[model samples]
Target: MSEQFHAFQTEGEGTGSLVKRTVEDLPQGEVLIKVHYSGVNYKDGLALHKKAKIAKDYPMIPGIDLAGTVEHSDSPDFSKGQQVICTSYDLGTAHDGGYSQYARVPAAWVVSLPDNLSLKESMIIGTAGFTAALSIHRLEQNGLTPEDKPILVTGASGGVGSMAVDMLSGRGYHVTASTGRLEEEAYLKKLGAEEVVGREDVTPEKIRPLDKQKWAAAVDPTGGKVLAAILSNVKQHGSVAVSGLTAGVEVPTTVMPFILRGVDLLGIDSAYCPMPLRKEVWSRCAGSLKPRHMEETATEISLNGLQQALNDILESKIRGRVIVNLQK
Candidate 1:
């Protein structure tokens, strides 16, 4: 019998289809992982649904987050049977990624799984969780603290936003979650949001360079108008850490907030983050920054269910994180 495994590959541009793949078909790498879990992110949704051109290569496998054990290794630093995680750094884009049952990744892109996090738990906290943790890390490094006034988390129902809410709130920060889906108010509160506001509350009818001071800081993933509004309302010397552009990239605002309020707009780039900082952030995610409501913040789906889950995420129907169980 042929030694084969299942993978979802895109032949051209649109949605990829599942097919059998042999080990030889994988990209060159030092470590080959028998992937146990992966996660669906917003970028995965856009790429899979053809809403955005995310994959740099046509025959791409679109899963930016993977966690499993090393089945084989050519690097002296890694040994077979060692658990690891590979995320970002071109995975699922310029390089083949974790959508398959097996993934061959450069040893440099892999991190030994933190002792406290399980494979399934790691995928639940995948890229989205990591982005959230990095955002908070940067903000705190810029002087944000739990004693400050409420921190507004935009797009609170989505994965990054939800994780931000949970993690920030877990650390004793006063969290005010804002979402277009007002019906999820109960859900956001459950994730530790002290307050839940409607999207319209955050996106004003007309944005000013500065507005009434509302939040001490903000974790904004939606970007665009929501970011513009948050910038206007952040208190003096506060910061806004932005990670995603789901609401579009344009920010139509002046520099009054930066000049007068001294607000810092910190950009978070989870992909290609220096390995040292990346490992530090991952360690924090497995430690102090880990979401207390993690189990409530994620749902598991099989590889076969990815197509629909991708569409749901793009349509803003997914709440929290969605993990892919390769064994299923």
Candidate 2:
């Protein structure tokens, strides 16, 4: 008989409820990983929504990120006892994901954990950190520079936002962080934000065709009216890298920012990103771009603790990162 291991499974029509799972029920794949840690994300919370549109099928796992040691593999590129990380792609969506004691993934979806990063450390950074790194990479690709005034990071109390502030500041870019959680102002500053502002500072009651140029660039994870406001006020020739829609998906705005000021809106999708780029970004997360005091960014939980964790994420009551420890 195949050994059975516990997994957080979601099933039925509508939004699936939390349930237990077995390894033998997982889809066939080239790699079998003994998961050590999994990270909770905003996307994972949406997967629980009846209309989330994130999980393509029922009975799916909802974790988008995991770090572990290989237990078995059909491909020579991976081996037993090797450390690796998997995020985005079909994981936690169309296939079995990281909300389990074990996970089997395609060899192509795996990246060996970079040097100097532990399995727990990788998950602590998780998908949020990866997306933050990608946002900065895109901004720099579009000509954003540290010398170009101050950069802005919206939703700065959350995982991706906090990571962006830390990474940008680590690279010598002055970051102005914006958040509704004013209580976290000191915390954001500790993460290297040169300035911390209230969410209202970036949110405009009346969005004009254009507003006074404020930021050289911005990393925005909360897209909606605030994005429209940010776009209207971005400096000439500046760019905005957007990765989330926690504020809702619709963005109401005009083209003046793009047409007159040459402002570029860069979209960031960590999932489905090409493997070459994925490897490069993770490498940076392990190196110069790694944030200081990373352990301070996460709250560890056990496998049985996912429900409350997911609920907190949906309500936006959780701060920083939430890591699930399978061994617990």
Candidate 3:
């Protein structure tokens, strides 16, 4: 049965114009999903605006995370009507993504919807929340804990940063949220950040190799100079989980922090993480790392609302998450 769906497509030259299309038009994949919800992320916003080199092709659907039900599957592992979540692995970039009523994704990229999450809640967490959980997991595995010292989260107003604050704080770590939005100080504290500091608090005076150690661990979504500053301030033997280049990609710092202080720069790539580990991380997100205000951290929108959301995210005017309700 052919079904028409609304999608935000990035046509040539990085323009996102809404297009109404049918399921039959989607690329062939082992699984066909009826998308229930999707989430707006900075990358998705970039895709919408044709920035960040995220979309590999024009006329691409630009949502990196989706939650829905399996309509059909060539693979024996999944059945029709089974709920599922799909994110990353070329989605919304190399392939048509979740910004539609239906999506066809490779079976390899699909994850069974965990019981603790509904389709809507899954998208609420989306790729941003997943990245946050993975960062925390890696940091803990690297010997970080609440006792290590106060953990700092940069870009604390964004999705990944906000989720990281919630997760780290829930795990008993004292969280310092760094953001330029002083207006959200109470909001950050509501999300469990023990302290809310200005973005300038972490900005470095010089491109130093190392500085006075401050945090025991850090979760950084803003890369570039912010990441450099975070690395410089992390205590000896501390770890910093690095994700995203929202600020910029160039990290202008020396290896003094890494070599002398034994600082670990952990890179988080959620797209191609191993399936087993990915599932494990999802399980953690559904349980221990689940943000108490998962819904509070998100604002729900319809497909018609995406363009404005994209604009807000790109302008850094948005705080917390934005989930797209396809059914709306």
Compose the digit string of candidate 3's lDDT tens values, residues 1-328.
6657788777745457778899789998999999999998988878754456778878788899999999999999899999999999999989999998889989999999887888888877899999999999999999887888799999999999999998888989999999989899999999999999999999856756778889999999989899998888989999999988988999998889989999999999998989999999998988999888887799999988888898888889888999999888
TM-score of 2: 0.96
RMSD in order of candidates: 1.3, 1.6, 1.2
Ranking by lDDT: 1, 3, 2
Question: Best-fitting candidate, measured by TM-score?
Answer: 1
Off by over 4 Å in 3: 12-14, 49-51
The CA lDDT at 29 in model 1 is: 95
Q: Model-by-model lDDT, in order?
A: 0.91, 0.89, 0.89
Instruction: State the lDDT at 73 in candidate 1.
Output: 96
The TM-score ranking, best first, is 1, 3, 2
- After superposition, candidate 1 runs with Cα above 4 Å error: 49-51
lDDT (C-alpha) at residue 2 in model 2: 75
> What TM-score goes with each of the models?
0.98, 0.96, 0.97
Model number with the top lDDT: 1
